[model samples]
Target: MRLAFNNFISIYQGLSREIWVLSVVSLINRIGAMVIPFLSIYLADAKGFTLAEIGWVMSSFGVGSLIGSWLGGKLTDKFGFYPIIIFSLFTSGIGLILLKELDTFYEICGGFFLVTLFTDILRPPIFVAIRQYSSEKNRTKSITLIRLAINLGFSAGPATGGLLIATWGYTSLFWVDGVSCILALLIFVLAIQPKKKIVEENDDSLEENKKSQSPYRDFPYLLFILSMVFFGVIFMQYFSTVPLFYKEVHELNEAVIGLLLSSNGFVIFLLEMPLIHWVEKQKKYSTMQIMMSSIVLVLLSYILLIVGHDLWVLFIGMMLLTLGEMLMFPLSNAEAMSRASGKYQGDYMALYTIAFSISHLVGHNLGMQSVNIFGYNYTWTFMIAGLLLCIVLLQLFQFSKKREELSQTAK
Candidate 1:
């Protein structure tokens, strides 16, 4: 146990102080990420909306996210990450606080859209910041550390949000979430100053050549992005429709549901860094192979739900899903970062984030509507089919990347 603990501690040794500070900021911000997880439930219980209606409102959040991510990426490239990150944090906090005031269906939709717009604008800049702060060798580990912090906060947030909902009601969640964002903003501003300019190690000609190539023109990367869209769609079901399944099918309550969801975060927090470190040390499996295996785990997770209705099934399924998440996210992030070139890092990261935004736009509505119309088992089956497709895409991307590498070698 001591040996294992020391090994675990070793993975964190080389990360820069700025990366740690960013992780801390993410922790603070995500700790208040209480609203979105329970938003569907709140809509159903408090607003008396139909599942279909709730899906639409949730999709509005996706729409806003899509726009915000695109805008943020462009703005980050033009204005730099510092100003964009600060602006997003401050505006998003105010939006979240104001979100609690809306009661009507349309009002709620617009509110969610506006709030998520500002919130998601934070993604590309943050990704760029991570790249700037980390060395290539430690980049994936750094990303995992940040994810660990986010998951830790998520674990605390939902568990606390559940209690808050039980006592003070859902309104309390919004206030807490909003306040946390502002607090995170203050911490970020006080701790980290802006860099004057990004310094790249690539020669001018190579850098210029890379800067001229748009991500949209990269076929293999596009396939990878599409796979992420499918992955996001599959993973996002847990946030939107899965809770409803627990409530209606398993007959679980708000607090219990919160605990179950929080368990994903907790599991990731405990295991991700070590697991990532171990994975990095292994030369036997390629990153794509690891990602494919992770997808299989997620696929099996849904299959478990299809086969069993027991509470234990939920826990086991969550464990599988969390394991898959731990494997998939950091590696995928590294892949995206690797693809990014000089002057276009924001563009690359934006497209990567946009995949999830598209998933948000499409996934929640699809999950909820499928559940409303076809029932939970069918929804799970549908998601399994989607994962299968995603796996195929990843394989194709891997093949294409290998072919490209071989061609370059021959040259």
Candidate 2:
């Protein structure tokens, strides 16, 4: 136990103060992130929307996210990350607060789109910030640290949000979520001093320019992004269809569902860093290899659901899914950062963020519709198939990357 504690401490030793502050800001913002997890349920239970209508509403949120990601990337590159971050936090907060007032389906759709537009704008800039703030040696660990904070908040948020919904009503979730975003904005502005400009090393600039002359032109990177979209589509069901599955198939209530969701966050909070640390220490697995393995775990997770109906089966499935998430996300972030040109970091990160945005636009709607039309078993089977396709894409990417590396070495 003493040795285990020391190892845990060691992984966190060298991250920057800025990284820590960013993690805190993420934690604050995400702690209030109660609404999105339960949005489908809220729409159905509160507004009397059918599954199809809820899918459309969620799709609208995705549409906003897709546009916001593109806009945020462009804006971050032009104006820098600081102002964009501030704008996103403030505007998204206000949007969330105002969101509670809308009643009609169209109004809620429009409102959610606008709010998510601003909310998602926060992603690219934050990735840029993480790149700027961290050293290469500790970059992945830094990303993990930020994820740790987010997961920690998720651990608390859903559980609390469930209680709030049970006792006070769904409207309370919006107020809390909006207030948290603003509070995170305050903390960020006060704690993080503006970053000073650094003169780029010639090698760094040359390498960045070579790799990212144009992200649009990079075939391999684009392929990698496609794989990420698949991953996101499969992974995001936990937030969308999985809850409804619990409620509909298992007859679980709001509080119980929240606790189950929170379990993902709690498991990640406790185990992800150590797992990451161990993986990094091995120094043998490439990023793509790790991602492929993670996808397999996620695939297995869905398979468990297809095979069983008990509460224990659900818990085990959640555990497998959470483990896959822990392995996939931080490494994916690092891979994206590595591919980004220092000169156009925002643009690159934005593209990366957009992959998930695309998933959001497609994943939630697809998951819900699949569940509604085909039922849970078919839906889970479809997700498993998606994961299999993702693995193939990753393998292709690995081969392409290896060929490129060998060619570069020969030169």
Candidate 3:
């Protein structure tokens, strides 16, 4: 027990004050993340939108997210991380507040798009800030710290949002979400410096960094980003398909589905840090290896679902899925950072963030389309094929990254 406690503490030690502040900001924003999770239901029940309308509204959010990430990356590169992040937070807060007044389908859709745009615009800057704040050794740990805060808030958000909706109604959710974003902005303004200046290295390093800035020029990194998109697509099924599966197959109610889904966040909050620390402490497994293991776990989780229809089986599958998420995301962030030069970190992270955005658009369609056309049993089988392809892509990415590093060093 003493050894275990020390190990957990070790994971958090030596992180910079800036990273801690960012994590706090993340926690604050996510705690009031009452809008998005319940947005579909709110539109359907409160606003009287048809299923097709809800889908269009949600797709608009995803499209806005993709553009927001790209725009944020460029802005962060030119103006630095602080301004873009602050602007995004403030924009999202104001947008969400305005969203409550919009009743028409088009108005609501536009409002939601703007809200998601700003919210996603905040992401790449956070990654850029993490790279700026942490040393090489603590890179993965820092990203994991932010993720820890996110999961912590995710675990709490829906439960509190549910209560707020019950007591004060859906508009309260938007108000609270907006207020939380502004509160996060206040924390940022008070605690963090307004600008992050890029530290200069030697001329050769500067040239290399500049060259790496354009992601389109880096073929290997592009392939790696593709792998990330695939990973994200498969992982997103947990959100898109798993709930529907539980409903249709097991006849689980909303309460049960919510409980089952929330467990993913709870388990990550409880165990992710310790698990990450333990993995990093081990010298044998590389970041790629850890990622591959995560992929395998996700694959197995889906396989579990394919075999069993019981609630316990669903719980087990979700547990595996949670563990896979904890292992994959921070490690992938670290890998992406490692491959990027300092000047291009924002662009690299932006492209990485876009993969998730793409998955948000694709995962649901993949799940629903497959299930509709082929049935649930075959849908899981199709996902297994996708996971296998991701494994191959990850392996190739690792090889390509190593080769690029060797070529750079030989110069």
Candidate 4:
């Protein structure tokens, strides 16, 4: 037990003070992430919207997210991290408040779009800050710590949202979620030091800068983005399609659905850090190798849900899904960071954020349509097959990289 405890402690040994502060910020923000989790259920159960309507409303969030991520990346590069993070949080809070009063289809869609835009705009800047604040050695661990805080907050959010929804109705979620963002902004202001804006560039230097920072210029990184989109679409189903499935098929209430959602967080909190530490100790797998294997677990998770109708199967699937997330997310983040230097970290990470945001844009709308038109089994099967294709791509990427290295050596 002592040995195991020490091993666990080792995972956190060298992360910077700033990283912990950022993690705290993330924790606060995510704790109030009640609205998105329950949005579909609210629209369906409370407002009597059809599945197609719910899907489109959710996709509006993704559309906003897509624009926000792109703009936030460019803005963060031109300005710095602090202002963007602060503004994103504060405005997102206001957006959430505004969302509560929006009941009609168009009204809610527009409101939700603004809410998601402001919220997601923060992602790239936070990642840029993470890279700035951490050492290369602890980069992956830093991302994991932030995600750990997120999952910890996620564990609390749904559990609390469930109770609030049960007792107070859906609007309570918006209020709490809004308050959480404001709280996170306050914590961030107090904890972190001000970062100076990047030095202004001359016209020639600006042109050079644009060329260097453009994500389109990097082929391999673009390939990485493609893989992430697939992974994200599959993973994000937990938010969109999965909850609706539980509620519709099983006739579970908000509280139970929340518990089921919280299970993902519980699994991550208990096992992710310790497992990552152990894997690092083994030193047998590359980041890509770990991530690729993790995708397979994601496939298995969907398979479990498709094959089994028992509640226990839901728990089992969530465990597998969370485990895959634990492996893939942090490693993939580290991989993204590895591809960039300090000069264009914001742009690179922004591109990375786009993949995640776009997945939601595509996933929610597409997954919902699939579930509504086809059955749940068909949706899961399609996702499973998509993951399989991702695995093959990852393998091919690794193989090509190896061949390129050999060719360089021969020269």
TM, every model = 0.87, 0.87, 0.94, 0.83
Runs with alpha carbons beyond 4 Å of true place in candidate 1? 1-4, 38-56, 100-108, 162-175, 201-208, 241-260, 309-314, 372-378, 406-411
Best by TM-score: 3
The per-model lDDT (C-alpha) reads 0.89, 0.87, 0.86, 0.83
Model 1 scores worst on lDDT over the 10 consecutive residues at 201-210
Write candidate 3's Cα lDDT for 1-411 as tens digits.
999788767778999999999999999999988777898899999999999999999899889899899888888877788999999999999988889999998998788778888888998899988888888878888999999999888877888999999999998998999999999999998999854466533347534654456876777788889988988888888888878999988899999998998898878888887788788889987778888899889999999999986889889999988988999999988877765566676787788889888988888888888888999889888888988998898888778767776776787
* Model 4 ranges with Cα > 4 A deviation: 1-7, 41-55, 101-105, 164-172, 197-213, 238-261, 303-317, 371-379, 399-411
Model 2, position 219: C-alpha lDDT score? 68
* Clash statistics: count for each candidate: 0, 0, 0, 0
Error of 3 at 57 (Å): 0.8
- Residue 406, model 2: lDDT of 74
Q: Give lDDT: candidate 4, residue 318.
A: 83
lDDT of 1 by residue, 1-411 (tens): 999789778889999988999999999898888897798899999999998899788778778989999988888888888999999999999988998889999999999988888998899999999988888889999999888888788777877999999999999998989999999999899999998877665554434655777788878889999999999999999988998989998899998897888888777877899899899999998898999999999999999888867888899999999999999999999999877777678888999999988987888778978998999999999999999999999999988877766665565
Write the residue-wise lDDT of candidate 4 on 1-411 in tens digits. Answer: 999788768778888888999999999898899776788899999888999999788778778989889878877877778899999999999888778888899988898888888898899899988878877767788888899998888778877999999999888888889998999999899989875643322334333443465666755567788889988988889888989988888788998897888777777888887777666666677778889889988898899888878888888888888888899998888888666544566788889889988886788778989998998989999999999988876777667556645654565
Cα lDDT tens digits, model 2, 47-137, are 9999889978978888998999998988988888999999999999999999999999999999999998898899999998988888887
